[model samples]
Target: MNTGIINQQGLVFLNATGAPVLSRADSRQMRAHITKSNFAKRRQRISQVETKGGESNKQTTQQALHRRKRSQQKSQRAALDTNPTELPTTESPPCAPSLQLLRNFRYLVFLDIRPTVQDPVEKAWFDLITSEPVVFEASLAGGMRCWGPDKESQQNADLHLSRATNLLVDRISCEQVPSDAMIGAVMTMAFGERLADNDVAWNVHMEGLINMMQQRRHHGVSSLPPVFRSLIALDFMNHLLGFPRFYHLKVVDMLSSHGDQVLSKLAPIPADLSLLKTAVDAPETGHMGQTSHGVEEPLERVRLATRALREFNDPYVKATSRSLEIYLNLLWPLLFTIDLESVGSELKDAMSEFRIKACPYMDLTSPHYILGLLATEKDSEASAWFLDRIQGSVQVMRQRGWSDPLSVMKRGLVHEPHIHHQFTALLDDGINGLM
Candidate 1:
């Protein structure tokens, strides 16, 4: 059959017989078929277009990329918040001004005092001189004993000098004194007797007294009467300088019961040129003020304490060690404020002696006084000397297997300049020596 458009209504097809056929359908009917077929085809094309548009959207791809980025960021944040070791953390607190001051002062004192000791004996002596009292009585007695000679003679001569001395001898002879106490006492008496130019017999007497004080200080015996201790300290100071009653009383009254009180008392000591000059050039008495410097009477009062320290011994030694420690602790800052250069050498020697001989038994606070004095000095040479000595000491300590040697060195370096360089050099030398 030949199919062709017919009357614009439907498709006509020729039958097998090639004759004209008159059979035909209504126009509306044929038109309906045509419309239906066209509508179906158009629907198919619309569906194709919609499918293509849907395929082109790409929303899923963009969403997936966004999701991956978000996931990565979440992982990074988790990692950042996680602390591995499970250790607790604390916020750093503010620095304490007083503590900083003390540290700076200690560094300066170490620098000033590390010299003048050629041997371990001097070093040990220095340690004993700077220790704090373990016993309340020792502390109280020390304060009183540090005043002047008159007070020492009045209060401590009978108890500490005579009675304590006898008891100490019996204990020492019987070997009843504990080893540490025995060593401390022997050292104390040796140093004390030396200061007083005492011979062997006096030294023997001093040994016992020294032991008793050391033991008491170490153990912190609080039963000691405060008044008795104060009187003992004043008497010790008096004996040290042979100062008269009036001068001793004046100085004794100035001593305070606590560290703060001692520091407050130091505020009034004169720092004028006259005082400085007298301290520098005072004859045979030297810094002791025994010479006729013709200075004000009050200035002499200030000097009395120093004089006592220079002449400290067992009979009147009650609190001189600790008392002087407190006194020096307060006095250096005042003196440094006035004239650092003149006082620097003397301060250094005094502190060094204390650190080396007395620090192990005495208050560690005393060294800070020397440190304050060193800070006041402008001399680089002196500073270098100080640093070198500290480095050497640290090395020695480390070689002896001392714990926290580095800490000790670091402590020495704190608030100091160019210390790292000095320490590095010293450490290298120490390593080489060990090798």
Candidate 2:
């Protein structure tokens, strides 16, 4: 006999006769329904927890990304704060006009090489012209006058010129020994005056410059800077134009000794000069070569000229040197000597040969080439014809806005007390010597 408790589907019993009541299928079904309901409830609770965890994980990830972004911003700010030079300042960036003006000045004065920082003199000169407002304006004036000769540019140039002059005068009074920058400023002013065609003003600046340079020499600064090379070229032009030189003979010689070195510093010799081989191969020539009845001289003049030309890597420097060579070697003797009969024909021939060999390598736009033309012409007609060609070239240069230092230095051979006058006298009057 089974003694057990049995319940109906929705009720509980205290006691019952077991086997008949417990064996019902509906009771077991009811229990199974209750178990299925409990499992559904548990699954609902677990899903709710997982949904909350997902939301929390997304928020945490977003917060981490935001922190990282803010840290990067702080780092960037810190970098900017530390680098002072990179920070913005009150000074405005160089405008197109100033940059263009500086470019013009560079092309006119430095022959487009722009001064190298490796050279102290060039660096000093470059800094003055590009950084100092007054000196920059003064330097800019030359380019302005040369490029277009516009009235507005001229007016601006004059304004800058007056200011620069005052600055130079004030500085000279204060400093016992003028600095290189000061000398450069004065040189710039003199260049401006020259462009303005103010001989008296230019002369005043030159005199001041001479005194300053002399003081430098006395202070044991014997080596002249490369910037002085341009001054020397200008001085040579002055000599050619019959103006008395301001530089003393000793200074000229001292500087002359280092001229090649100075010029080599200005620019690099091109790695591949097509004409270099041609110049090197040109036949040995001159009176020196005429020795021993057709045996070439060990010191061939053509070779010497080629070597001299190579010494100056820049075309501008070469032109300046060429003009100086003509002035010293040929013109000086011809102008100062008492007798043409005493002047050796070999001297003229050597110079002519040098000119021929050196001509192929020169920048034809250079006014220095005109000096060569003038010195080598055998007759007045040829001189006049070349003069006409030069005038034509000058007109073209003016029309096209070209800047050549020598042409400006001599005022294109058209100004009063020009070199052409002396040249014409020598050729037309059959004058043996000016002295």
Candidate 3:
């Protein structure tokens, strides 16, 4: 049996019909070629479809853009229709905002956050940009950050404050019943005076505001908005400082409502003092009677509240708290001054105690220091001390990157006899009725 060798490509197997057949390798090549051709055709079809879809998508995008442009135009037209005097336009390049406007913006932003105006206090505060002279001047007064750094700005602010006071007086006299806006304006003026450390002026304004609210029959704290509650909290603190009780509502009632939470957190006066007193006196009043030990209990609570103030992360808040603490200590030397037998008779003890305990770098030229001296009946000394510290205060504030270095010194300047006539009156009449 002789077997003949055949080339792999040429090798073939005969079918049952005895016909010559393609080798397995040749069959595989044919099938592969067909499959590749089919794939190429399928890919070409897909590419064509994708191209058409892309064109359709481009058209759709163009249509959408056109519609948006039309919608914007319609909005502008509507705005134009609403306001005939002002032309409707898109947001233009912001030119430099006026200083007053900038200040107003900052104030509005501040009002939106905590430790300022919280809750839906009223819609009236948001409507302050009206033509009302009281509102305008009040805004200028409240915008403390804008004008505190310089003498010129300060003078301008004073002018605005004067105008605001005049306007407020007129409004109060004219209106049969006080409006919320008017009330807010008066409160704002009082707050501004407080910030300026014009104790006499602040009390005066605050008294007037209370009178106005009383006239409005807001005897109940619940009748007023949360804004007034915050005001009442301040008044309560003022009461603790020896001012007559301006609020009829108990401190507990005010605290129970939504008010300045920060003040509540750090108040020197506890909310339930009256309740505690009542309970201690009449044990049958409530379950809290057992807890009401004595004045020491309330005093301990006050000390605890003040601890949170010391732990404040904000340096500004801490400094303000320290200043307030020093003021409280300075208020009643007979009651609070330190003695050999007891820790002190006063709220924070004698000025000597603070001198020893206070940080050496503390701003002695601060409003707290000068006012403390004035309250202690050391006017001549306070004036001299304030004058000496004016330069130092300015330098320190500037070093701290404050835009309003002069404001820090000027806060105490209002107490100078040469600077404010009220200071002279304060000296003559004392804290009760200087205004």
Candidate 4:
């Protein structure tokens, strides 16, 4: 109970009272005891002060050292993993990712099941604009869960995309594949590449995809992935968006079927609009190639293809849905903003009208880039609702060790130009609840 290191001998001397004055040796002992007691008291006082000050100093010192060590290790790892002199590439792997390649193979096996969506043939032109952002946002949303880090998920995504591209390219070059296999192959590639932002190689991939679809059109294929309709819709949407013609969805007359001179319609642009639009007449082409009755042939083809992918992966959030709707919602506005002289003014007007109709009706599950579009419009009602929902969802994320979702979106949506202040306010509202 006592903090003082008391001596038994000192207690005995104190108890001696008036009986110890006769002996000189006793007097010396008494004086020595008093001196020792005073020294002990001063030492105790000094130790108490040191204990309080030492603890805070130790904690601060430990934290600083840990931070420095972590920073150094991060720099070292960066130097090791990255090539300072070389540019990073998309298709050519730094080395073959056997595990990722295997994963891609396994994924194809699972995805080839009977179509669930209403079409199959139109899947070649799957939702091109929104796919990339959806993939991107899913990876970010995925960062919240107990799984591999974001970089690993991204690599896994890249692995599937690159592997699919290679497989399809090889399949197209080598020989004829079963119709079902062709649909499955294109679906796999589309699924892999849809969420890849500004991935220009999609045209080459889509070109091959359409070629496969064309070869398989005569024979009816059983079981289409459900997404086939949306894919075809995306192809039309891509053409409408003034992107290059990555697909070959054209209509031929009965005369052409009889081996007569067939009318070949070319898309006015390259499937990837990021590249220069090809020199082609817009008046001669159709965004969705139409048959004699103004029906897109892929309409039925897409309908059959859509039936292929039946079951859906349960999405944890609207942003992670297997369907391309969420990203499409974001893509429409971005597409509307593009002023392409090559595109028919009617197409541009239609897109603008569609964007306006859709813009005010975004649901909570919309991609984060919708915030960028919302910022561009600065719609008071839309902003208030979106900001409220975002605040509620991401507030809980902080407690769960997630980085700010708004900040995440800030980075995700940077490709689109908008009022920086308005966007910043939205981010601050969700992050700091400033709104």
Candidate 5:
């Protein structure tokens, strides 16, 4: 390699547009002035190279450049393993666009791929730089150019998303034995849908993720941290809102036992999530009977779980109220399914409070099955707002992907408010499928 060209290659772009530039030597000096911890080593390396008095200037510069590159690679690897903000200052220009793409993806989803990633994990998640789903890849390329400076990119994003949605449905249908790459692709597409303002696509992508979780849980670390934090919360939210849960509560137990377990039991004395399943089953699995001696067993289990949750407190923990909120909300469905008339009076205030607290985690529209059911009984502001939202979304619901809660809301109980028989017929199918 020509020494002149290698020296020029060391110069780095100062901004996203690659307009401003700083000579590699000048940037290294500036970085040394700013950060003593890392640049100190660079300075020491420079000194050692300088002290070798017999060496020619060409050899000296080459050695110094090699030392600098090595240091940067070391620091970059460390930063990626932990906090990426601690990135090396000596980044090369060749990798700039690819690096920028990664930064955008990370900032949006917060899925940093931080767990003990092996070959399989790396191939799936990290390979996005080379091969992401067409949808997300287009959406990202579009995002980079979508600002006022580029109208074509903005239009391209729309066309890409429209085509992407169609492609995603086909992708989901075909991926029966989903690989990690497919999971990562689904995750990427979901976030892209969020960015593009495609709620219907976003919701559909979310359902695809849950399906992947069910299909692929046993392949690797099934109870991934996000699985506990995100999916369990989703199940609880839907369950509480009076929709059948799309995921099982026991997955929380499975997550608690294995995987990147980020969730902590919030109940000061948290009950086993299995207790939730046990409580529901105690009264009746398929069909619940009238409140008799049999009712006390399930009710007591509910009381203990509720009491633990109500008293829960751990300031430092994430999703502190999560376990409590999801649990309390779940009780509404089980209790109401067993006896609807009294459940309304009992869970009225708690349900209202829960939607307020848990709204940050899942889509507000998706988690309000209970709200729709309650709307059938009587109209409150919460129920009224939900009804309006659902009414407006009838078109989206009619789509093939929005089958679960949409079907329940439309052809069944919520569609005919006074119809008690539809509710009874749904007892087994709704909770099992939904949960």
Candidate 6:
């Protein structure tokens, strides 16, 4: 038998009309020729299609670019029509203009006044004054005088003061009182003097003035002048160190010696020793409207004690020691108050006792240290206990609308990233290591 083969477009054809004819060489040659022709045709088609697709894509992209350009031009034209005076004719440079040093000086002065101004109109006036280059230049000259040592420096200082006074007078004349700006100017003068360490006399005079302002007992006085009260508190704390006998006296004592007078002027004093003993010793006293067992309610006792401790007069060392003791004593009941089956109340008691013993030297600033101590025995269990207490306190605060110390501390820890970092670092150190 013989086979005949035909080839066209890279395909082999069998010529089987009449007798069959077969030849391997003829079949191989025919297939090769047909394959080559078909491959060339497919390649050509692919190349043409790719070129057409590329051109179509390019056209679409160009159309989009043109549309975007037109939209931007329209926006710019509309902006010019709406605000012709403000629109720039030419494209602005990418680089920003350098801030003038004088302008910066004015900004600082303006910011100094912003917090004190109650009226929005007065605030806006101060803002305008600060934004002006002339005001800034005047401020810079005055600031420089705050340092230079010469008669000319004194003249410059006087000129700056005159400029500020004139600005203030102008505002007043315009029926816009410059109370906020005047206070800011006064504060700046005091602060500048303090920085220079030039004259203690100015500080003394200011202190006297602040005291006089406070004596007026106006509603605004409390918000207006805290400087004098702060200084008095600092001095009182310092003086207590020298006079150990009076260390028990609180910062409030410097206001007036008579407890009745002081109490009348401010918030009510926390219950006295007599009142506290009565409340604890006899539950019937129930000043806070809670029937108590022989044991005091920890949170209430802490609230009262903290207030009393703040008011306590004593040497710094003795007062702080007493305050710690009182605080620890108030917190001691939490050990028994917790559910023993769930949290191991006996361990809690032991931890509380340990804290009480360590209270003399323990730094309350680092809360993680306290947490570590709690976790020393059965860490997982202790963490659970601490978390539970926090939840309970949060619940109570929600119900009563009054925050507890733990809640305040927890919020602080969450918001302050630095504190949180420190806390986590301390936690990693292990509770037993702290002990």
Task: Tell me the alpha-carbon RMSD of every candidate.
Answer: 41.3, 34.8, 31.0, 29.1, 15.3, 32.4
| Preferred candidate (lDDT higher): 3 or 5 | 3
Q: 231-273, model 1: which lDDT tens digit per residue? A: 2343332232232111122233333332323223333343432
Better of 1 and 2 by TM-score: 2
Per-candidate TM equals 0.24, 0.41, 0.35, 0.30, 0.35, 0.23
* lDDT scores in order: 0.35, 0.43, 0.43, 0.32, 0.39, 0.35
TM-score for candidate 2: 0.41
After superposition, the stretches of candidate 5 with alpha carbons farther than 4 Å from their true spots are 1-228, 237-250, 258-291, 310-367, 372-379, 395-405, 408-435
lDDT of 3 by residue, 1-435 (tens): 211111223332333322222333432343343345446655665565555666645444445546656887687566445432122222211222233433333333232222222222122234332324465457555552232345434554576677678877887778556655566677667656655666687678766776775666653422344334433432443343333222333333444444545555645353544534444456443332343345446645644665566564332334344444544333323222333112111211333222111111223323444344344333444334433444454454454345554443444454333423434454465432111
| lDDT for model 5 | 0.39
Per-residue lDDT tens digits of candidate 6, residues 1-435? 333222222222323222112134543443333345446654665565555666645444445546656776676566545432122111211121122322323222221212244443333333433432223223433443432334544454555555544554464466432233243344344433432333463354355334433433343323222222322322222222121111113334434443323222222222333244455546464443244653345435545544464452322222232323322332233322333223233333333332011111112122333333333344465555544444443443333223232322344355435434554564476522120
Candidates arranged by TM-score, highest first: 2, 3, 5, 4, 1, 6
Model 6: which ten-residue window has the lowest total lDDT?
355-364
* The best candidate in terms of TM-score: 2
Model 2 stretches with alpha carbons more than 4 Å out? 1-125, 214-220, 233-238, 243-367, 373-397, 400-435
State the number of backbone clashes in model 5: 8
Name the candidate, 2 or 4, with the larger TM-score value. Answer: 2
Rank ordering of all candidates by lDDT, starting from the highest: 3, 2, 5, 6, 1, 4
How does candidate 6 score on lDDT?
0.35
Candidate 5 structure quality by residue, lDDT tens digits, 1-435: 111101222332323322122233442332233334334555676777777857565457576688768886786567545531121222231211234434434322232323333343232233432232443443343332222123433443455455445655666688555544455455555544543445676567667766766766655535332222443443443343334233334444444555422333322123443444454456454433233454556556655544454442221121223323333433444443333323333333334433112211123234334433443343555444444444434432222133343443333234324333434444443433331
Please state the error at residue 24 of candidate 5 in Å: 40
Q: How close is candidate 3 to the true structure, as a TM-score?
A: 0.35
lDDT of 4 by residue, 96-200 (tens): 122332222112222112333222112212222112222212221222121122443344345434444554456557665433334544544443343333345
